[model samples]
Target chain A: MSALGSIVPLAFGALRRNRMRSSLTSLGVIIGVGALIVTVSSGEGSKAVLQAQLATLGTNLLIILPGSSTSGGARGGPGSGKPLTHADLLDLVAGVSAARYSAPVDRTTTQVVIDNQNWLTTVYGSTPEFFAIRDWTLARGRFFTSGEADSGAKVCLLGQTVATQLFGNGDPLGQVVRVKIMPCEVVGVLGGKGQSSQGQDQDDLVVMPWVTFKSRMMSQDRVHVGSILISALSPDEVSHAQSQAMGVLRQAHRLSDKELDDFTVRNLADLAATQEQAADTQTGMLRNVAAVSLLVGGIGIMNIMLVSVTERTREIGIRLAIGASENRVLLQFLVEAIVLSAAGGLVGIALGLGGSLALSAINHWPFIVSPGWVLMAFGLSMGIGVVFGFYPARKAARMNPIDALRFE
Target chain B: MSGEPLIDLKAVTRTYLTGAATVHALINVTLTIAPGELVAIMGPSGSGKSTLLNVLGCLDQPTSGSYRFEGREVATLTRAERAALRLSAFGFVFQGFQLIARTDALDNVELPLVYADVPGPERRTRAMDALARVGLVGREHHTPAQLSGGQQQRVAIARALVNRPRLILADEPTGALDTRTSIEVLGLLQSLNHGGITVVVVTHEPDIALYASRRLVVRDGRVISDDRQRAHDAAADLQALPQKAA
Candidate 1:
């Protein structure tokens, strides 16, 4: 170990004497490692942002839509049955063991008009429990009470985008907006949620009480629900919630064990997981690209080291003649290569992390610092140093000292 | 003054095969070098003076022959063992001075000890002592390029002496210097020999051969003449020359 330790300074001195050449030789490794770090950080950031948006939808949340119907061998897909009734929503809320918050939903696209300006937007109808299930918070006023919902009051909540479009700088609270010829008072404005994972604006819908929607806006008055939003008490209870909800729905539709139910329950967790898997594939592809770049960088190091060995033949000869062993000569050149690449690796990491932080700040994504990735990249760079430095080092070690001494 | 032989060679021959032609660089020749002798081997270019120096320095092995240092045969040692022997027992100098460029003289002198795994403090002390012995007391920090030709040669001699080896092999030590610098370098070597280290120098210059106590002339792979003489005093010669401004 002491013998190996002594070669370090000699190696560093040799490299330090050729500063520009050493740095240029390491440039390929720098860019390779830097690109690797950026790819990993950005990939991690994107995943974090996706998970956060999923959190807003509430962990283990589920949505139920009316199931398909088969009429004379013509089978329609889901959302084709008789629209779900208010009684079904109430039964599911009361019967499902793991279900925490359940609310009936109804929605339509219509023009929301203020005094002179009008905009086409989605309007939704649900009980107050919809806010709890969807984890939505109000920005200005309160959500309508249960009494207001049961009495079919004309009060409505304005999403941030709709409020901004209709009221602009004016206070949207207590202002009546016309929706399909009916004037509804805006009781509150929803908080901004930015964009969804699909890049759609989340704050673009207006919401009203279910009873008001059934009585005035909906074309049919059979107390039918377009869909139902439900969330489990906890993430672990999602599967249990799904099975219980399915049983209650099947029984309510008067279906036997062999008969298909008239409702479909979709687990949002599974959807999020599938999207995460897709992101993982993308991350894997980026990593492969990084590995290829590292390989190219390693080749660059090998090429330069070979040239250096050729250039320093006389030096090698001198050291050998002065009692340096074959291994000592090998270690000197190998360590020089390692120091070059390690310096490049560290500089690349610093630059990559800074670039990642700036990007996250500009794009409003979460900044993730993964020490494990940094270590792996550094280890890989060192490994490249060893692997690439070996052939040239061996060539120098194998040289005959007498011939090397005589080399011009 | 002769004691037990420090180096013994028996019919050592070195042959080189290049493109199906065998060049006999050295023929079978027996020689013994005793301790405390400054010997010069003189031959023209391609007359194999270098080949003889390399064999003596353990930098090359004779194609066929027996070489013994003290009493141990050299042909039986492994490459690593031979290297270790060279590290601990032999020091070498070359026509080029062979000091690593861009490295300070102190570090250049410390090279052998570094390979020998000597501790840093002791290595530094011994290297400094060796530099002082070569009359380069305050030039430890000077690189080869920063030093004059004679100074650079002194640094190389310091590196050779830093290990305190039994033998020093120098091939054309004064080849790159002018007459004055060459005398200065030869004076340093003479001083080292007076201190009881065995010094073997290979050169073609009769001026350098005159400084040694013994000379072996090589021609056509054969030692044609061996003569002993009273060694010239290089220091007295340096003193006789006119002094330059310091």
Candidate 2:
């Protein structure tokens, strides 16, 4: 037989003789590799979910909220300062050349009743441009037009949750639902958006004209809009649009150079980028932990191999005395160590993939199988075998045949 | 019996440091062996007969000596070259049989050929042939643990013969066997030696030395006697033993 061909079977036979030791020695490798796979796949899966959630926030969109208001020395959060006004929104749309569409938004939570069914949901006041900027599509009927909005029409769009709660399977397109005291006709049902990245249900709201909302449902003045939503002409112009809108809003608010503007222009892209950076940092920490476990697994293999060499000293003597060269004995033991570790790697990969599959299924995330990482993990395990198995194999090879044969 | 001596050792010595004292294992041993001869080396415990066999088989290097195999100086060989020489020209049979525990008789016999880089099919064929030569045909697949003491020794002898070495070095070949089994093993060695292979056996038992045509008695790290005589026929001795209950 070829030298390596023969040596390999000899190695296998020796390992088979001590099956329990072989398996236990490889357990560390299995757990390390499995952990690596789980961490990486989950990291990728969560990243994908985040990207999808960010996409739902609309492309190249920006939100303009009133700056925080300090009341009794306690600073209230954003959207509590001098409220955005209709005049400021008009000035921003006219002055910001990068802006594609702009709409005013006011939101409040109230109960709506229809027939014998009553459900509580947030109601939003917005112009027709709001639907375009949100990229929202109607699953049924149609959205209210700008003319209807200007005439202060009592037409409204129902979010998926509101539609389902109020109408069940029945058609609600022409049904009139009582919003607080005003009965408003449901013009459309918004498409289901599942959940936001923060796990909040996005499909649970009602939309109507800003004039109708301020005049009827809300106890607020008609002059102030709560917030303004804007979309840039393209993705590349989002930053330019943000800066332009900020400059225009500062001028419209009549703020001096030394004073802070009474508004905040936030880019959705920037928020998504920050969230992505946080996820990446978490994934990097997890990867380092997995790497350390793999290193520990390698040390475990080395320990067992050293013990195996000592236990098989007599076997080494027999081989050497039987005309086997030092290299031959070394190759035999080296092959044994490699086979043990590589076998562990294979089982670990299977375990990691299975664990990833179960976790993704449970969490409703995509099962992303990165072939590159799997191959890298396998190669690294084999490298661990070679690196850790060398010392013991060399020790076996360097033994004097006489002393070795006589080793008790 | 030969053009040049098959083995020639001049003033060979081997020493070791136990802890504080230097001990000589072999002291200025001079010896020669010819082809087609069966030589027995007799000694008490720690008398260095095994050391002599090791030096003859090229398993160890002499401390300060001129030792030659055929015509090549032994000290001139590199470690790998010496290993290659052992693989090609020498076969060792130890008293313990030294058959790998879990391996079958056939694989045990094929080990020397494996180290010699012989290809698979031929190695198996040669191993089977060697097993048959040692009268171990039906027990080819039996592991060392499954075989009797005589059968294990026969398997070791088959391993020694598989490489078709010109010289066979057996250290206390019958040390671990009963008289009947030892006789059977000795009969196998006798037949191989008669096939023109030179054989050297180290033994503490004087009865075992009677089977060789030449005997050298070692004492206190030196050879005390060397004599040539008519060898007892081990095949006849095996035939004379009474049949035991199966």
Candidate 3:
């Protein structure tokens, strides 16, 4: 009686007549749509998980790496370039508007020995403020104080992994481990930090007062330390703080106007943003490719429907002679095509959702599915049926009744 | 005999091209049939009998000539308009019985009304009545495959009558049936003609043609003779005349 009701029976009849062919056609759309769904969902999920990890590093932190005359080399330039000095740090603390907290760290890779056991680890020479800058915490005792650091106290804190390795479930507190010639007492144990995506152990390190490590242990006048971790008040002030810190350091270094800046900046927030953009681009690209398969599936339906038209030529003529209008005849075949594609789309959506959901467990990652993709796949299939099915439908509708009656 | 001609054709010509060759299926044909007339169009193979039925039933457009159906000139009718004419003014009983396969008798009969946008209840009621009139009320749910050839033809006839068309066009309606079943179908068609419905049957068999009161003999594409004969039980008596005469 209505358009919806009329098409239902017609579509149903078509599907009933060709069960296996219809299922096969739908399988094509299912695989294409499912692949795109899994790709975009997993991509988005990975991006979210990665960003959450980056957030734990503190969005406010800015990194400053150690190098001599511009990022070219660690080799000293001109008159033997000095390591990041306290004068440069103190000037920035006094002059910069956005430096809420900053620390100049002295870092190296060295082996610490206890009896016959020796652990190769990254050693940090830092003030107490370094913990606050990197958003780290102590698992056991206390960090070295500012006074202790300034006074060059020969005490150190073992990272969780190093302590566990050397202490063997026994207390590392009040115990002493050898670092080069000096034996440093373990005053604290830092919390466990697991491996990064790059597979490096975060807890395989030790921290000491900057003064004790810099002057007494290494004894070299020039420092080739690693990164100086700084934290700004807010993420909005990071760019400003960075520039102000850079300007203060450049004036302190007295570089020529033609010289390009030496150090590399690793802003976790910016890194997260760039990765998000790349994921979005990849999602779009994958979705487009998936849509092409939907298009191909539609074309397949048209091709099959065209064959069906020839096979059913006499049937169409019978309908026409029995008083079916051209529009009615067209609608019959069109309904058949649409029913096929829509069925395919529905099956594909289920398969895709199941795949992604199951993949979340199999791969141990988050899975996400968007409703928009499902709707799009369905609409695309229907559109393909209508657009591609028009020609054959027209041919069927225009068949001569006399010739059709005689068709064998 | 008393009423106006329900169909009038003036020099209708229908042509079709097969690759490079042209087929003059029907040419220079003028014919007229009034209400309540029982007419038979008799012609051999390749004589354009089916083509003539297509034109007469408004299922085709003549390449040249005028055709009036129920007082309307249908020479240039659009496909939709011809479909409407088929729905409202003419019903067809095809040679193959042409019942939609896998569909029940009632569904087959109700199909044309579906396109006419007839409401479901009224269509069902009228289709049932038509099937009952053709002695197929018990077989309304039977598909063509499940029914005998005679029963299938009766369902097709019921489908033809469901629209209450002014003209009933039977194109070899009994070709697929036995001699006994053909008589039963021809008897029903004659009864419908007796009820003031215009009936036209196209048959090459003289025995079949003898059942109709009026006959048009076709030679080539043109009508060679139009004559009236007394009603007869031609299928029973025709054994004396040789099948070649038919």
Which numbered prediction scores highest in DockQ against the true structure?
Answer: 1
Which regions of candidate 1 fall more than 4 Å away from where they truly are?
A: A68-82, A250-263, B238-246
DockQ of each: 0.74, 0.67, 0.67
lDDT of each: 0.88, 0.90, 0.80
The 10-residue segment of model 3 chain A with minimum total lDDT is: A73-82
True contacts kept of each: 0.78, 0.60, 0.76
In candidate 2, which residue ranges exceed 4 Å CA deviation? Answer: A70-74
Q: Write the per-residue lDDT of candidate 2 for residues A237-280, one digit (tens) a residue.
A: 99999999999988888889999878888899999999999999
The sequence of per-residue lDDT tens digits that candidate 1 reaches over residues A222-268 is 46789998889899999899999998888888888887778889999
Off by over 4 Å in 3: A68-82, A112-118, A137-145, A152-160, A163-193, A215-217, A220-225, A277-285, B233-246
Q: After aligning candidate 3 to the native by TM-score, how far in Å is the CA of B136 from where it should be?
A: 3.0
- Residue B87 in model 1: lDDT: 86
> Which pairs clash in the backbone of model 1?
none
CAPRI grade, predicted model 2: medium
Candidate 3 residue lDDT tens string, A1-408? 364566568778867888888787667667776776777777767776666566656558777664445346566642244456667677777767787887778778888889888888888888888888876788998888899988988899998899988888989998899976679999999887666545677788888888888876677543444456678879898888888878877776685778755554456667777867877888788878887887787778778888888888788888888888877888888888777777777777778788888877786677766788667766876777788777877778778876776688
Q: Candidate 3's interface RMSD, please?
A: 1.4
Angstrom error at residue B104, model 3? 2.8
